[model samples]
Target: MIVLLGITLAVVILVVVTWMLLTRRLREKYAALWLVIALAVLVLGIFPQLLETLTGIFGVQVPANLLFSMAIVLLLGVSLHLSWELSQAEDEIRRAAEEVAILRAQVERIERAISSGKASGVEDADGVG
Candidate 1:
Protein backbone atom coordinates (compact mmCIF):
# COMPACT_ATOMS: atom_id res chain seq x y z
CA MET A 1 0.00 0.00 0.00
CA ILE A 2 2.73 2.39 0.93
CA VAL A 3 4.70 1.40 -2.13
CA LEU A 4 1.73 2.18 -4.33
CA LEU A 5 1.36 5.56 -2.68
CA GLY A 6 4.99 6.35 -3.25
CA ILE A 7 4.75 5.40 -6.89
CA THR A 8 1.66 7.59 -7.30
CA LEU A 9 3.42 10.52 -5.70
CA ALA A 10 6.45 10.05 -7.91
CA VAL A 11 4.29 9.89 -11.02
CA VAL A 12 2.48 13.06 -10.02
CA ILE A 13 5.75 14.87 -9.47
CA LEU A 14 7.09 13.64 -12.80
CA VAL A 15 3.99 14.87 -14.62
CA VAL A 16 4.08 18.27 -12.97
CA VAL A 17 7.75 18.72 -13.72
CA THR A 18 7.21 17.69 -17.32
CA TRP A 19 4.43 20.19 -17.70
CA MET A 20 6.58 22.94 -16.27
CA LEU A 21 9.38 22.12 -18.66
CA LEU A 22 7.08 22.05 -21.65
CA THR A 23 5.62 25.43 -20.75
CA ARG A 24 9.08 27.05 -20.51
CA ARG A 25 8.56 27.70 -16.81
CA LEU A 26 11.47 25.50 -15.90
CA ARG A 27 14.89 25.53 -17.48
CA GLU A 28 16.12 22.38 -19.20
CA LYS A 29 18.96 21.99 -16.71
CA TYR A 30 16.59 22.02 -13.74
CA ALA A 31 14.06 19.83 -15.52
CA ALA A 32 16.68 17.21 -16.15
CA LEU A 33 17.70 17.18 -12.51
CA TRP A 34 14.09 16.88 -11.35
CA LEU A 35 13.39 14.10 -13.83
CA VAL A 36 16.35 12.16 -12.46
CA ILE A 37 15.06 12.55 -8.93
CA ALA A 38 11.57 11.48 -9.89
CA LEU A 39 12.86 8.45 -11.71
CA ALA A 40 14.91 7.48 -8.69
CA VAL A 41 11.86 7.73 -6.51
CA LEU A 42 9.80 5.67 -8.92
CA VAL A 43 12.44 2.97 -9.05
CA LEU A 44 12.83 2.79 -5.32
CA GLY A 45 9.10 2.73 -4.85
CA ILE A 46 8.65 -0.08 -7.33
CA PHE A 47 11.39 -2.19 -5.85
CA PRO A 48 11.64 -1.35 -2.18
CA GLN A 49 13.97 -4.26 -1.68
CA LEU A 50 16.66 -2.11 -3.23
CA LEU A 51 16.38 0.26 -0.27
CA GLU A 52 16.74 -2.63 2.12
CA THR A 53 19.85 -3.79 0.31
CA LEU A 54 21.31 -0.29 0.46
CA THR A 55 20.59 -0.04 4.15
CA GLY A 56 22.29 -3.36 4.82
CA ILE A 57 25.29 -2.32 2.80
CA PHE A 58 25.52 0.96 4.67
CA GLY A 59 24.97 -0.70 8.04
CA VAL A 60 22.01 1.53 8.83
CA GLN A 61 19.95 0.32 11.78
CA VAL A 62 16.65 1.22 10.10
CA PRO A 63 15.39 1.89 6.60
CA ALA A 64 13.91 5.21 7.74
CA ASN A 65 17.35 6.34 8.75
CA LEU A 66 18.63 5.56 5.27
CA LEU A 67 15.73 7.43 3.73
CA PHE A 68 16.37 10.44 5.93
CA SER A 69 20.06 10.37 5.10
CA MET A 70 19.37 10.21 1.39
CA ALA A 71 16.90 13.05 1.68
CA ILE A 72 19.38 15.20 3.55
CA VAL A 73 22.10 14.55 1.00
CA LEU A 74 19.81 15.35 -1.93
CA LEU A 75 18.60 18.54 -0.28
CA LEU A 76 22.13 19.63 0.47
CA GLY A 77 23.24 19.00 -3.11
CA VAL A 78 20.29 20.94 -4.51
CA SER A 79 20.93 23.81 -2.13
CA LEU A 80 24.56 23.99 -3.15
CA HIS A 81 23.71 23.98 -6.83
CA LEU A 82 21.09 26.73 -6.38
CA SER A 83 23.55 28.83 -4.41
CA TRP A 84 26.16 28.51 -7.15
CA GLU A 85 23.64 29.48 -9.82
CA LEU A 86 22.52 32.50 -7.77
CA SER A 87 26.14 33.61 -7.41
CA GLN A 88 26.69 33.43 -11.15
CA ALA A 89 23.48 35.36 -11.81
CA GLU A 90 24.51 38.02 -9.31
CA ASP A 91 27.86 38.48 -11.03
CA GLU A 92 26.24 38.75 -14.43
CA ILE A 93 23.73 41.31 -13.17
CA ARG A 94 26.52 43.36 -11.63
CA ARG A 95 28.48 43.36 -14.86
CA ALA A 96 25.44 44.39 -16.89
CA ALA A 97 24.67 47.23 -14.45
CA GLU A 98 28.22 48.48 -14.68
CA GLU A 99 28.10 48.41 -18.47
CA VAL A 100 24.85 50.34 -18.45
CA ALA A 101 26.33 52.98 -16.16
CA ILE A 102 29.31 53.43 -18.45
CA LEU A 103 27.08 53.70 -21.49
CA ARG A 104 24.85 56.25 -19.76
CA ALA A 105 27.88 58.41 -18.91
CA GLN A 106 29.08 58.28 -22.48
CA VAL A 107 25.62 59.22 -23.72
CA GLU A 108 25.50 62.18 -21.32
CA ARG A 109 28.88 63.39 -22.50
CA ILE A 110 27.83 63.15 -26.16
CA GLU A 111 24.59 65.03 -25.45
CA ARG A 112 26.53 67.79 -23.65
CA ALA A 113 28.92 68.16 -26.58
CA ILE A 114 26.05 68.37 -29.08
CA SER A 115 24.14 70.90 -26.93
CA SER A 116 27.25 73.05 -26.41
CA GLY A 117 28.01 73.03 -30.14
CA LYS A 118 24.47 74.11 -30.95
CA ALA A 119 24.55 76.93 -28.39
CA SER A 120 27.84 78.37 -29.79
CA GLY A 121 26.88 77.73 -33.46
CA VAL A 122 30.07 75.73 -34.02
CA GLU A 123 30.72 74.47 -37.56
CA ASP A 124 32.29 71.15 -38.47
CA ALA A 125 34.39 70.20 -41.53
CA ASP A 126 31.14 70.21 -43.56
CA GLY A 127 30.66 73.91 -42.63
CA VAL A 128 26.87 73.66 -42.14
CA GLY A 129 27.28 75.71 -38.89
Candidate 2:
Protein backbone atom coordinates (compact mmCIF):
# COMPACT_ATOMS: atom_id res chain seq x y z
CA MET A 1 0.00 0.00 0.00
CA ILE A 2 2.69 2.46 1.02
CA VAL A 3 4.87 1.41 -1.91
CA LEU A 4 2.11 2.14 -4.38
CA LEU A 5 1.54 5.54 -2.81
CA GLY A 6 5.20 6.43 -3.02
CA ILE A 7 5.41 5.48 -6.68
CA THR A 8 2.31 7.50 -7.49
CA LEU A 9 3.62 10.55 -5.67
CA ALA A 10 6.98 10.33 -7.36
CA VAL A 11 5.38 10.05 -10.81
CA VAL A 12 3.13 12.99 -10.11
CA ILE A 13 6.05 15.14 -8.97
CA LEU A 14 8.09 14.17 -12.02
CA VAL A 15 5.24 15.04 -14.36
CA VAL A 16 4.67 18.38 -12.66
CA VAL A 17 8.33 19.28 -12.86
CA THR A 18 8.52 18.35 -16.54
CA TRP A 19 5.45 20.34 -17.34
CA MET A 20 6.83 23.40 -15.59
CA LEU A 21 10.07 23.11 -17.52
CA LEU A 22 8.27 22.80 -20.87
CA THR A 23 6.10 25.81 -20.09
CA ARG A 24 9.17 28.01 -19.60
CA ARG A 25 8.18 28.80 -16.02
CA LEU A 26 11.26 26.95 -14.79
CA ARG A 27 14.78 27.36 -16.08
CA GLU A 28 16.81 24.40 -17.35
CA LYS A 29 19.26 24.55 -14.45
CA TYR A 30 16.54 24.43 -11.80
CA ALA A 31 14.61 21.82 -13.79
CA ALA A 32 17.67 19.59 -13.85
CA LEU A 33 17.92 19.78 -10.07
CA TRP A 34 14.22 18.97 -9.65
CA LEU A 35 14.51 16.08 -12.07
CA VAL A 36 17.40 14.66 -10.09
CA ILE A 37 15.42 14.82 -6.86
CA ALA A 38 12.36 13.27 -8.47
CA LEU A 39 14.41 10.45 -9.93
CA ALA A 40 15.92 9.76 -6.54
CA VAL A 41 12.48 9.62 -5.01
CA LEU A 42 11.29 7.33 -7.77
CA VAL A 43 14.20 4.98 -7.22
CA LEU A 44 13.57 4.86 -3.49
CA GLY A 45 9.87 4.37 -4.13
CA ILE A 46 10.53 1.47 -6.42
CA PHE A 47 12.83 -0.21 -3.94
CA PRO A 48 11.39 0.52 -0.55
CA GLN A 49 13.93 -1.63 1.18
CA LEU A 50 16.85 0.31 -0.25
CA LEU A 51 16.62 2.87 2.53
CA GLU A 52 16.86 0.14 5.10
CA THR A 53 19.92 -1.29 3.39
CA LEU A 54 21.50 2.15 3.19
CA THR A 55 20.84 2.76 6.86
CA GLY A 56 22.48 -0.53 7.73
CA ILE A 57 25.47 0.24 5.59
CA PHE A 58 25.84 3.64 7.17
CA GLY A 59 25.45 2.16 10.62
CA VAL A 60 22.34 4.25 11.30
CA GLN A 61 19.68 2.75 13.48
CA VAL A 62 16.82 4.94 12.29
CA PRO A 63 16.37 5.66 8.59
CA ALA A 64 14.38 8.81 9.26
CA ASN A 65 17.33 10.34 11.10
CA LEU A 66 19.53 9.79 8.08
CA LEU A 67 16.96 11.41 5.83
CA PHE A 68 16.59 14.38 8.17
CA SER A 69 20.34 14.89 8.33
CA MET A 70 20.66 14.74 4.55
CA ALA A 71 17.76 17.11 4.09
CA ILE A 72 19.23 19.64 6.53
CA VAL A 73 22.57 19.53 4.74
CA LEU A 74 20.93 20.01 1.35
CA LEU A 75 18.89 22.93 2.61
CA LEU A 76 21.97 24.56 4.13
CA GLY A 77 23.84 24.31 0.84
CA VAL A 78 20.93 25.83 -1.06
CA SER A 79 20.60 28.63 1.46
CA LEU A 80 24.29 29.46 1.14
CA HIS A 81 24.13 29.55 -2.65
CA LEU A 82 21.12 31.83 -2.60
CA SER A 83 22.79 34.14 -0.12
CA TRP A 84 25.86 34.39 -2.35
CA GLU A 85 23.78 35.16 -5.42
CA LEU A 86 21.85 37.82 -3.52
CA SER A 87 25.07 39.44 -2.37
CA GLN A 88 26.37 39.56 -5.92
CA ALA A 89 23.14 41.11 -7.14
CA GLU A 90 23.24 43.74 -4.40
CA ASP A 91 26.80 44.69 -5.30
CA GLU A 92 25.91 45.01 -8.97
CA ILE A 93 22.94 47.19 -8.12
CA ARG A 94 25.08 49.44 -5.96
CA ARG A 95 27.65 49.90 -8.71
CA ALA A 96 24.97 50.66 -11.26
CA ALA A 97 23.39 53.25 -8.95
CA GLU A 98 26.76 54.96 -8.53
CA GLU A 99 27.28 55.08 -12.29
CA VAL A 100 23.83 56.52 -12.77
CA ALA A 101 24.51 59.20 -10.18
CA ILE A 102 27.73 60.23 -11.92
CA LEU A 103 25.99 60.41 -15.30
CA ARG A 104 23.14 62.50 -13.85
CA ALA A 105 25.61 64.97 -12.34
CA GLN A 106 27.43 65.33 -15.68
CA VAL A 107 24.17 65.91 -17.53
CA GLU A 108 23.07 68.57 -15.04
CA ARG A 109 26.38 70.37 -15.37
CA ILE A 110 26.13 70.33 -19.17
CA GLU A 111 22.58 71.70 -19.07
CA ARG A 112 23.68 74.50 -16.73
CA ALA A 113 26.55 75.49 -19.04
CA ILE A 114 24.36 75.44 -22.14
CA SER A 115 21.71 77.62 -20.48
CA SER A 116 24.35 80.16 -19.34
CA GLY A 117 25.53 80.58 -23.00
CA LYS A 118 28.91 79.16 -22.05
CA ALA A 119 28.72 76.22 -24.49
CA SER A 120 26.35 75.31 -27.30
CA GLY A 121 24.95 71.85 -28.08
CA VAL A 122 27.41 71.66 -30.96
CA GLU A 123 30.42 72.15 -28.60
CA ASP A 124 32.17 69.44 -26.57
CA ALA A 125 32.22 69.21 -22.77
CA ASP A 126 35.47 71.23 -22.56
CA GLY A 127 33.69 74.35 -23.99
CA VAL A 128 35.30 73.85 -27.44
CA GLY A 129 32.61 75.92 -29.14
lDDT of 2 by residue, 1-129 (tens): 887887888899899999998899988877787787778778988997898898999999998887777779878877887799789999999999999999999999978877776544466668576
**Every candidate's lDDT:** 0.95, 0.84
Cα error, residue 90 of model 1, in Å, equals: 0.6
Candidate 1, residue 128: lDDT: 79
**Model 1 CA deviation exceeding 4 Å by range:** 123-129
- Residue range 1-129, candidate 1, lDDT tens digits: 999998998999899999998899999999988999899999999999999999999999999899999999999999999999999999999999999999999999999998899789998568878
Winning model by TM-score: 1
Clashing pairs in 2: none
Q: After TM-score superposition, what is the CA distance of residue 36 in candidate 2 from its true location, in Å?
A: 1.4
Winning model by lDDT: 1
User: Residue 31 in model 1: shift from native, Å?
Assistant: 0.9
